[model samples]
Target: MAAEMTVSELVRRARDGQARALGRLISLVEDGSPRLAEVAAELAPHTGGAQVVGLTGPPGVGKSTSTSALVKALRASGRRVGVLAVDPSSPFSGGALLGDRVRMQEHATDDGVFIRSMATRGHLGGLAWSTPQALRVLDAAGFDIVLIETVGVGQSEVDVVSLADTTLVLLAPGMGDGIQAAKAGILEVADVFVVNKADREGADQTVRELKYMISLGRREKGPSWRTPIVRTVAARSEGVDELVQAVTDHRDWLIEHGELDARRVQRAENEIQAVVAARLRAEMGELRGGATLAGLAREIVDGRSDPYRAAEQLLADLRS
Candidate 1:
């Protein structure tokens, strides 16, 4: 724990391309280390400047290809981009294959583009526990745009909504039942929708269905943002420019309505609460000891006590 490293030294080392320093800073934030709060307080002012975009969709929707294309386009326009591809950890092995990184190899040597693969680490909310910390590191490192590509596990992926400045949901043609399965939460959180593999049959129908769903859920003055369905063949780099323009338009709209700052405030509040919850759980576990908690859990499961009552008793015991 290099707790003595000053913010300036950390920032300088991060800028000098020290991956370990960057990783450590992110780890501190994710683990809710005391120093993380101090570092975040110092770095908060530097955030809200980078455009954080989140991309999520069903598996095999070509999200990585689209992300790569978008990153390339941003770089061509002289913008530095950072990409965080969140992959699900294999339950059997407890490791991530990181297939997204493999797909994004085109930019491997580009200093302007920094790409990192993160595991969801069994977090239930469709986001990696370390995601917020990673984004902060990217912001501090002076990236103009930070793109977060999710694990693409359907509805749980809504966590990205609270974390990103703009959330683009990617869908492909011929999804059939998969589209219906994701319609409830995934459809509502998206600020922009991309229909990748547009050259395939049923692309237009997918777009129309998505638009109808959006229209049905529309509320006057409720977020008041139109979610546009842009077609793209990301593998071939088709419609990449239009997709970029749509993202820009949505971001500009956010800026115009003052929602950008409001959203940032909400995200900060969420981060603080998450950190608090995590810390409380850790401290409580340490105080109780793992064996005690395990015994309590077993007792509850055996119907010795109801879960809610057992929780109350534990709380009372802790307070005492």
Candidate 2:
């Protein structure tokens, strides 16, 4: 469908708030279309405006519920919101499982809200590889806020930090989340800790544990933010306004300390590196099936040549 529209035309329409055009542009990004570079070129100037927020945690922490509540809160303030809910891929379809999409259907008819479910496609980082590019599409489409809800938190899921301006790590009372947070290194990446399902028992204990951990973490010798913990029963949208305020406060802190620019610069660097890596992989596709690489592998396996020398030979052949 995107093939029917020129990248410039799609970008223009998306900026005009045409939902279909915005969806098409994101689809182009998701599918890694040949026109993706052109789409990026058009989107580049219009970006760096939206506040990117990431919500992540172990599964069943009400991340989807919290995201929905946040969208409601943002829309009440008349800010256009974009949500990227990265879902685990369906084994048969290789597409989003649509769990988040199903839960957030209340906003489906809200013109100010755009919710997209992205399949991780087996990406280890709990995000679709195309997510940064998708964020560009949303930013260029004039969203005031973008919320990225990762597939789930794990050792490898903190990659969201590289993209978000404020990362809200959600935890539930009964989930052993405090221990999991410590194991996953989430304490380092969390800008705000949200204990969703706060009405449940053990909620206070979770909060206490988080505050203790926060106290233990060392901070840089400069203006530093003591991460705040907010409690919420996301199912009822309770405490969501306070959660929103916490995010705003964190954003304010980021701006006041001149850290927003620094973070964005780092984000751009990560995006650049990802692009370069993807390009290299594409260029190396030939070596994957070519005799040069196979020969190198055979040599290494047969002990005829060391792995380092075989790698060197493969690179040399690739160069030629």
The 10 consecutive residues of candidate 1 with the worst lDDT sum are 120-129
Candidate 2 Cα deviation (angstroms), residue 240: 0.3
Candidate 2 has its poorest 10 consecutive residues by lDDT at: 120-129
Listed in order, each prediction's TM-score against the native is 0.87, 0.91
lDDT of 2 by residue, 262-308 (tens): 99998888788788767655555567566666777788889899988
Put down candidate 1 lDDT per residue, 156-189, tens digits, no spaces: 4566546899988899988765456365446666
Clashing pairs in 1: none
Which parts of model 1 have CA positions greater than 4 angstroms off? Answer: 1-7, 16-20, 27-35, 89-104, 122-128, 154-156, 177-184, 219-223
Clash-forming residue pairs, model 2? none
Model 2 lDDT, full chain set: 0.81
lDDT of each: 0.75, 0.81
